[model samples]
Target chain A: MTASTAGPFDTERTRSVRGASWTAFRAMLLRDFTILDKRLPQFVAGTVMQPLMLVFVLTNLFPRIGQAVGGGGGASRFSSLLMAGIVAQTIIFIGIFSVGTEMVRELGVTGEVEDRILAPTPIFVVAAEKIVSGGLQALFGAMVVFPIGAFVPSTPVYLEVRPIVLLTLTPLACVTAAALGLTMGARFSPGTASYLFGVVALPLSFLGAIFYTWPSLDAVPLLQYALLVNPLVYASEGFRAALVAGEPHLSLFVVYPAMIVSAVVFTVLGMRGLRERVLS
Target chain B: MFLVPRLQQTPGWLSRPDISILRPRMHSLPPANISRPGGTVTLASEGESAGNGATPHPGAADVISTTALKKVYPGGMVAVDELSLSVRRGEIFGLLGPNGAGKSTTVGMLTTRVIPTSGSAVVNGIDVVAEPARAKQVIGVVSQANTLDQGLNVWENLYFHGRYFGMSAQASRAATNDLLERFRLADKKTAEVEALSGGMARRLMVARALLHQPAVIFLDEPTVGLDPQSRIALWEVLGELQDEGQTVLVTTHRMEEADEHCDRLAIMDHGRIKAVDTPAGLKARLGGGASVTVRADGEIEKLASQLRRAVFTTEVQVVDGHVRISLPQAEGAMQLVLAAAQAGRFRLTDLAVSCDNLETVFVKLTGKDLRE
Candidate 1:
């Protein structure tokens, strides 16, 4: 049959395993992006809502109500300080929802509803492709949320942008966050997804150092050290190193390696969890 | 040529895969027997090379083959046991069994979803165990659930599947349109998958499975939830597949459906095959060999043992408070029934003569009715 019909993948290069796998991998990515494009409104709504609320309340509404933040850095410097933090928070949240919740629905404990896993590629590529897709969505979330954080304040937000740092640290932050989401998605079944918000997302949102720098938590010494376990803290700190260049955030030296390690760990765990769910 | 599946575990797969994984391994495989238990002229072994790991391939006659295939879940439940099957190209083969008879597990093993606990399955010359991804390139599957991409509309479902199988965008779109038209789903191309009826959704799934022109298509309970009209439509599509020379493996508990559509059938129970033969062959094997079932007022076993010797019956057994007597043929069957009844002291509460059919054959072999 193959001899009679030359498929799109019938060329000499494509007949090779590596070339065929690459072709299928790219096609899977194309499918992800195509769906994302078709549902642009939903993607925008999911990406923009939380950051829009955070920037509005903390920078715009808080000062008008006479609330003080950033230890009297004043509302404007406080805006600048929280800007990178909001970028980090937005990317992380978008990453989780874009990848995690959808996965829970697709690989639900009852049965697999996702047919994408049956793609003619190695099984692991399916999980890897999702992580990559989610990370890309998170990056877009960062772009959408940054302007809201930068310009929404009542006062002129003090700001600086380091192009190289932003470009370099942003991808690491996005993928780490996405990989974390994949781990949670794969670990929990559909029935226990509420615990995702209660146990996982709640801690990630509150203790993620979005409103205050990690150094500011020195007053609560135990809590300060405890938040180190959260991958989001590094994302927040890494963005601070990029957007607010000279702010009091965690060292970039520490942030880079920590995020990389977290991304690697989550990728392994998430892929294993998905495989175990399907292959068993 | 495809790499061994074990190598995919490395991170290098995400980057440039090593050329070493692309090298193909070839072996002169020996043919295998398509056998049945009890050696009753069904499933006779063709070549007696049992454990040589030289199981049959798709090249010679069968387009799909399995040798001693088994799947034991982690919890110690044996789902499929020592299953060997051979399916020729262009034929619709069936696995007919009640629920939990391991029919789905066996299909799962063949399709690359469930890894085998032992044994091997090869599809179109590819060893499913050693290179599942490559094996997937040759096989298509329609799972029991409606696995249409909820994210994509009906057309995009087929289009994306084509793309996933390495079709170019133009090719994917063309094939998608062609399949939608063929399945008579062209009008519903833009509709969301959630909006589709049970039958329309199933036809769309079958369309998607065929878009890439896979060598074998596996459909699990294809007509279970469909209406009669929809079932006819699906069967028409299967008939078209036969014309296209596509090998089909379907599983269903509907005896009549299997009897009418499948070229060969394997009746499975308790994770093992009770029989494998053409529907006509199966019926003929038991043809004219009707059974006389007697529910006696006295001890069933005692009456059963006495009747086994007194009556010129082929076989006799006591089951469910009744003694069943099998006759060699339809002629003189009445005299034997009368004789068996007299030996039981004419205390028959209820007596029945089962006609020869797939269900009867299933009941006679397993001592259990197919419909509970």
Candidate 2:
């Protein structure tokens, strides 16, 4: 009612468009969240399934079969390392694939995305909302994966849980993963989405040092540096440093700064891609 | 495919000029008669002159205007070609064209959906290409296809549309309630859009477009595929909008729709404007007058030539063994044609007389049926 105090349908009602852009942005987020709320079961299933399977097979089944993951009592240490890796992987996969696939459908001939684009905000704002929404979904995936990682393994995996590092670094990792997702989603079409999961996502997760620590990957020095090109590597290392103690992991200096830089780079590229797609 | 018989005659209401002033050449016809031919019915001049009683606000000029606006898709397909026109503040303008005629493309350019490849378009005084976001603030577009979010209910669809235009939640809710009632979707407020009937879904789409109370509304094929009753109901809603001084640009291929509802219309074909005028003005300019169809056998060319010489007949053409005669009055022409048939010793199988309408004008200008 306050927005309409001047009169209904009056063009001069909003003297400033900055406030209008913020309102539109919030509305876009609200719409996505409302749809997510209605489809909670699907969201939960999608977010939970991958991490559960990874933690169960590598951390639970392999250990029960007496396959030494790392060495004696290395199973527990490996389990703790895999916990962080699975969580990071869940966030990255969900963030990228969910948004990318959905964007493809929305931007197709159906033009369902037209409603969002029509908002009195820049096209980049719409793209940012998708990233933010994906980030939140990634964070939710992390939360769901943590419990499964904690209980699914036969070995009792101990975590340091540094409050400062855990709180700050986990969000950074989730955001970096979300930014990577945004970049991929913006660049790929729906028909190529399946290829993205099979070709791009699988390589990123496996090469991200999810199963082994970055320090351990120093054994294969060339592989360690090559894997850094994958944004998921920084996220996986950041999570390991935050959740596990006395483990061979990347330094806090490298993890934090790399995550931030990757987030910024991916966000800029994603926004550029979004503008091109929208205007074209 | 079911066409109402042309023999039913043109309704008197169809030609009752909506505006007070009628052009000198647009003389009112008798209840069932047609306009006298040979007078030049020029296309109404652009801008305010083309409007009925519609007036722009003092500070605001044309509601929508385009100058040489064109759209060229990738691979060299030109969807809209050098379109230039001006629509005043409160007139109901119709873009009449068949499928693939660039009506939708023109609407897309004006609505800021499809970026124009060349030229310029201004909506609500804001250049569409330069300030699309600002232009979007004052216009609402209902696309040809259903773009409603099927996951959301009817009320939610309207509410979100309003919110996108910067309306507060309370204002959006209020507007949603008002629109639902006006669109007769109040009872279906909580129903999923996909669950509604085709007509209800269309009404919801229109209601959603109007929730923000835009200055200019573009509706692309708003009543396509709807039943007759639903189409009429939608027309009444549009008529009411016109009465309340809302500027509307609607695209449809139905000649009767343009004839009955539009104050003025532009006929488009192959990405070009074939003609533009008031429905009756177009009918008068191109329709010639009334027409009589004579189904007869034996020397059709002779019958046609003989009929063309009659005092009332303007032209005659033989089409598929039937004589189609254009004349000022069908009543007198019918007798003359019948007497000619008897003199020629040709047996007349059937005869029908009808006044000129938009379909006739469309066929005359485009050399094809409106639906084609």
Deviating ranges (above 4 Å) for candidate 2 = A1-15, A71-73, B1-61, B294-309, B312-324, B328-351, B363-372
Native-to-model Cα distance after best TM-score fit, residue B36 in candidate 1, in Å: 20
Task: Name model 1 segments beyond 4 Å from true.
Answer: A1-14, A109-113, B1-60, B287-354, B369-372
Each model's lDDT comes to 0.75, 0.74
Query: Please, what is the TM-score per model?
Result: 0.81, 0.81
For candidate 2, lDDT tens digit of each residue in B1-372?
Answer: 111111001112113333122111111222121221211122332321332322122112246777788889999998888887666556788998778888988998898778999999977656789877766777788877788886578889888887777777777787788778878999999998778887888888888777766777899998988898889888898887776567799999898888888877888877877777778666656664777888877777888887776544557888988889878643466677788778778888899988877887777656664444
| Candidate 2 global TM-score | 0.81
Residue pairs in clash, model 2: none
Q: Report residue B44 deviation for candidate 1 (angstroms).
A: 7.3
| TM-score of each candidate's B chain against the true B chain | 0.70, 0.73
Over the true interface, candidate 2 deviates by an RMSD, in Å, of: 14.6
Task: State residue A180's C-alpha deviation in candidate 2, in Å.
Answer: 3.4
Model 2 chain A: lowest-lDDT 10 consecutive positions: A1-10
Listing candidates in order, what is each one's chain A TM-score? 0.91, 0.92
